[model samples]
Target: MTRPLALLALLVPVFTAAQPVAEAPVALDGTHQVDLVSEVNGHPYRLYIAPPEGYAADDTTRYPVLYILDGRRTFPAAVTARAFQDIYDGLDEVILVGIGNGEQTFDAWFSHRWRDYTPSANAATDSVVAVQFSQDPETVVSGGGPDFLRVLREEILPLVDSAYRTTGDRGLTGQSLGGLFAAYVLFEAPGLFQRVGINSPSLWWSDGETFATEVAFAEAHAALPAHVFLSVGSEEGRSMVPPMERLAEALRSRGYDGLTMDAVVFADETHTSVVPAMMSRTLRVLYGRSE
Candidate 1:
């Protein structure tokens, strides 16, 4: 209490500077990243998971989680687009998990997806068409849909649910072949996901095999208890629109009151360039945020 004048003067600057430096709060945007790795059916998968803001504070709160195929390249845009939806339109925020095909480069991803997303093509027929020198009737390096679906249903979904605050509802998003896989899932394992976004699905795959399957599937089930969003870019090609329309028509004809469907073709958009807008619209639509 009896400090000298010199000591008292020195303590003033120390006290001011010691006030925690008043750092600028960092202005965090409330985002976090987590890596989930697991082995499924002899293949290893790395999933990038982003839980929405306020995920951790309440133990009782749960949100729907979306599973994205081709997640390595697409997850960034998907999450950002969802964020924009949340900010601008007050959309319900959910968890985003992208399943990457383990390819860090472009070419590898193409080949890898062909093997994982397409339905199993007959080896005998493939040999004949492949010999034509014109082209193989069978898809190249294709036919792995069943196994990949197994991975999603058995391994990925369970693990993600255990780790994150996910609710009973689930959503799926994919493009092209991945979209084809989503289409197959709509029939093969309809109960797995409540919302599905199929973008420019390669209905051309396996010589349009999915069309026949869709017809059969709709015939069997009068009302599918799920929401479906189908999208294709106007400039993709003539063939793209018809198959998608046909599938939509097939589903609608079922007269299933539980089924909700929306099909749109964004004008002036091409295959490669359509993902961003499609992904954004998909989030808004399937997540019930669309105006």
Candidate 2:
């Protein structure tokens, strides 16, 4: 049926307006990206920086910096989680920094993470990972965590500190392999971060060498002055849950002074699905304001 001329004209404009139009991408407010090449590790990294609401350049307030691993995926999640907590739970405001390898593809990012997160090289594990990803074992490089930590300490942290108004208080959080790196940092340089979140850490990495690191830390120090949140999914199976529980127990058994540790096993969440809950709870435990 043909419509009247006036009706057709009105409908035409509406339909035309409703059609899809290409527009410039909208960026998150108060967020920016910085590309950095680490002098310590010679690895290029992309940092996703998000300042707290009402942050101002001239403001005297210096916020704590929360460094998140796997920034390509976790940065947005961390930002959302923090924003929600800030609104509903009275969470303290802090700067969020996401450390990414600057890769755009999954395989490339995976390769970088595999190289950067492991503490020791294991040919067996490398073969297993390569098979899982359908790649050659020799191509999968493992163990550059010490150098990665050096990159953060000598390069990333210093850059972030100089670029922003930040306090000495720092928090670090990572999941899976990234979590393993966080644990490594905890034992190797506990003083670098005041708060840490180890979410579903791949403690199985390198024959559970992180356990040995923990032992070394215990031998060297009588006290651990840090707030640590350790969490895992109940459904993550033997590889994840038990080691996390064991680590928690071992840390508790030491009775380390000034150590505020909170460990939880989230019900029915899988390794991949537990991240949102892990990030949310980690923020609350690590950054919640005192009432």
Candidate 3:
């Protein structure tokens, strides 16, 4: 019996090894890529668009759009999370538009994101980030956020609207520096997006310039008619957590009519580890079906 068992194990290994291998990876369904150039900044962008399951060009049903920042790293996660939420939690379906810089290397991607996401150029903040990443401060150039926003408004939005059937209900989500950019947009042009998700934002940028932006917005505008979801990891440290909580508090204290804001701190999660949970929760909060 022992000899037969040994022979069966060897046969099992041989059989498993004999199985055919796939020639190529299976692509995600209903997903397509679009390469576009930003007329505002002259930067090229790659959009990874994932339409909802069962989407069709001939179908007259229009869907909402969710623009995701850091598309290269976050797109797949967003797509998977959205699909699962829709399947299991009865979440509403929306088109996912991931904006990527088309960088092949991590260093190139890092530099490009730093340039586009920051609201202002600060040599002091640049030096700190440079040291953290082992990069030279001179190599990191920021202050392109305004232009990037223009690229989104004048270029990307039009392209997306023209290419797809959309309901004009827009959502924007980002993490870290991307989150910082989202916050900038929320204050700079609150009307652009109906839903905003800020996850682990680097509010420490430019000495908390985003707070000043918020103050300015609140001064001029009586109400902000948007759904804002703010979240952070409990382990993201004082620099991230306290500032985010402060922002939440400030927004709450304003008593802005028509503004629905929710802030959450996920325990046992770090900045890098909390992304999936944050994304999932953001979608549920912002787009969950009404009971």
Estimate the TM-score for candidate 2.
0.92
What TM-score do all the candidates reach, one by one? 0.80, 0.92, 0.92
How many clashing residue pairs, candidate 1?
0
lDDT of 3 at 57: 72
Per-residue CA lDDT of candidate 2, range 105-209, in tens? Answer: 878788889988888878788888898998756668897888998899999999999999999999999999989999999988978999999999999987889
Tell me the alpha-carbon RMSD of every candidate: 10.2, 2.6, 2.1
List the lowest-lDDT window of 10 residues for candidate 1: 25-34
Please, what's the RMSD in Å of model 2?
Answer: 2.6
Candidate 2's displacement at residue 23, Å, is 5.3
Candidate 3 Cα lDDT to native: 0.90
Question: RMSD in angstroms, candidate 3?
Answer: 2.1
Worst 10 residues of 2 by lDDT: 19-28
Instruction: Write the residue-wise lDDT of candidate 3 on 213-273 in tens digits.
Output: 9998989999898999999999999999999999999999999988999999999999999
Stretches of candidate 1 off by over 4 Å are 1-40, 122-140
lDDT of 1 by residue, 136-233 (tens): 34444557788888888888889888887789899998998788889999988977899999998888766789988877877787768888999999
